[model samples]
Target: MRSQQFLIFLLILKVNLKDVLLGFGNLKPGLKYSVLIFAVALPVMAYGSTLSDFSQYYPIWKPASDSTWNFILYESAIAIRMLATEFFYRGFLMWTLMEKMDERYANLIHSFVYMLMHIGKPPLEVPYSFIGGYVFAWVDLRSKSILPSFLIHFLGSLVFDLMIINQVFICL
Candidate 1:
């Protein structure tokens, strides 16, 4: 049987993917903003990753083997989760709460929830996620697509993972 992580990833993948495709696809519009937000956030996340002891808390799945398939499967799951997370925060939330109420409130609510998700994480990251989440939500609000937000979330997370691993391996 697939592990619990894979199962959760599957569920998220199905729901979030459907929402993005059905709700507000046509990703062309958000592509430019995605690149811009990602580029803008990359360096900051990189710097923050270095400052925080992220390696201690992340990459939950360790290498089972050095085989290519092992890395592919692991990273692919990570990528899926990143996409799913952003879709929920930036896409689903935007459609639901933002549609019902003003977008500013929706963004704040999303950011607060996003921040809460980081509670067990490093102290710095907890607050950072809220602020960063707001920025991404705002970007989505402006761009009218979650594409840019997804790109930023995924790339930012991947970069942090890389930084954490790099710091560990370099020191050893």
Candidate 2:
């Protein structure tokens, strides 16, 4: 089963190898990239704490009652979901909207769309998602790359998942 999965993954990877390589080639190196990454991540980390506090209002929002292995799998799945989300929202939607409108307007639209995407999530989460989307859109606009937003989104999700885990364990 593992081998089959690995083979399928490798096959998919091969198809996107050129785009992946080219994307990396286009990334700016050195201090500027590092600073942008920090700028993106630090706000998420700060705001994530507030989200964690807000999660307290929803006692049912904890992670599933699963084994360690299951939790790891869940975390991995969340990470993958976050990556796909960034690709869809920040990469595709933001890029397309920016092409059609001015930068400020596009970013506003992106943030609003991003907030709408979270309609099914807990109410407390919507505001943070809006703030995050705006920050990420701004970062993409200023940095001229999606990499920083991607990192920020991934790390933010990881932190949120961890918070869920902690809440679950505390309730136990």
Candidate 3:
């Protein structure tokens, strides 16, 4: 099981890197602005952190020493995982499925799977992902790339993580 996993891991990494390079090369100013404007809603993003806190899951452990190397490794793993998710859902799910079906229908199917993937987490997040998944899919379609979605997903989760850390830190 572990040996086969490496090949899949490498395949996914290659695909994501290819899309990222191409997506960055072809990126437009409008998408940049959309992300910038979207970022103004950090407080709204904190809602998920609130739910996490209520569920008593706040404050993922940090590096004991705040070492730069530790931070890089930790954040890089998260970024890679987040990018993999965006590529799978926004890139492959939207682009690949659109070939065999209507775009709207493809997005709907993608949304269903996206939400289903969120199962076993907090219940509130399940429905939220359904709605957010469609929006991310639509954005990927319009932007013609998964880069924006990756940025949004990555930074949005970062914000939530920071929110939880801040709350925990302040209390301590």
Candidate 4:
């Protein structure tokens, strides 16, 4: 499991590197776009960190007894699960929806659906997910690429899952 997680992470890293290399000349423009992206992201992330119960919405601990192997397997499973989610939500869903409507409208609808997907989780998570969806959608729109959103989502999920597995956060 440890190997698998490491391998997946490496694969993502490689792809991102390739993209960076291919788009080196566009870095300045991309960074300019990312400014708006981060402007939207920062405040939400800051506010989210302040909630005492925010952690409850995430899975923060491993279900199995203490063991390195178990931890690796659990975390790896989480990474894989989140990767699939990114593919569905940010990749397929966003692309398909965008094709059917203007970017703004598509983003709004996509964010709403993304929030709906979290309905069964913690009550707080419902709102959080909605906000997160909007932020991610904005990033996608501004960057004109899904890569930025995917990176953010992947990292966020990693931290959320690690917090859950470590018992730093409890699920509702």
**Top candidate by lDDT:** 1
Stretches of candidate 2 exceeding 4 Å from the true structure? 1-22, 25-65, 167-172
Model 3 earns a TM-score of 0.72
Which pairs, if any, clash in model 4? 59-164, 60-163, 60-164, 60-165, 60-167, 61-164, 61-165
* Model 1 lDDT per residue over 58-153, tens place: 666767124446646767888777777776677666656765788788878989988999898778888889988898777666666666777777
Query: Which stretches in model 3 have alpha-carbon errors above 4 Å?
Result: 1-22, 29-33, 36-41, 52-55, 58-72, 167-172
Residue 142 CA displacement from its true place in model 1, Å: 3.0
Candidate 4 on 3-33: residue-level lDDT in tens? 4564476477564422222123324444555
**lDDT string, candidate 2, 70-172, tens digits:** 5667667666666666655666567668768997887788889999987866675787688778877676555555666666666655555555456445654
Better of 1 and 2 by TM-score: 1
| Residue 26, model 3: Cα distance from true site in angstroms | 4.6
Query: After superposition, which runs of candidate 1 have C-alpha atoms over 4 Å from their true positions?
Result: 1-29, 64-69, 167-172
List per-prediction Cα lDDT, in the order shown. 0.68, 0.60, 0.65, 0.58
Model 4, residue 101: distance off in Å is 1.1
For model 3, residues 1-172, the per-residue Cα lDDT tens digits are 2424643864766655344222653457437645764666565666666674323552233661244455457667778787778777777666668778998999999999999998876777788788778877776666667776777777776556566555434533
Which ten-residue region of model 4 has the weakest summed lDDT? 17-26
Models 1 onward score TM values of 0.71, 0.63, 0.72, 0.59
| Native-to-model Cα distance after best TM-score fit, residue 29 in candidate 1, in Å | 5.6
lDDT of 4 at 60: 51
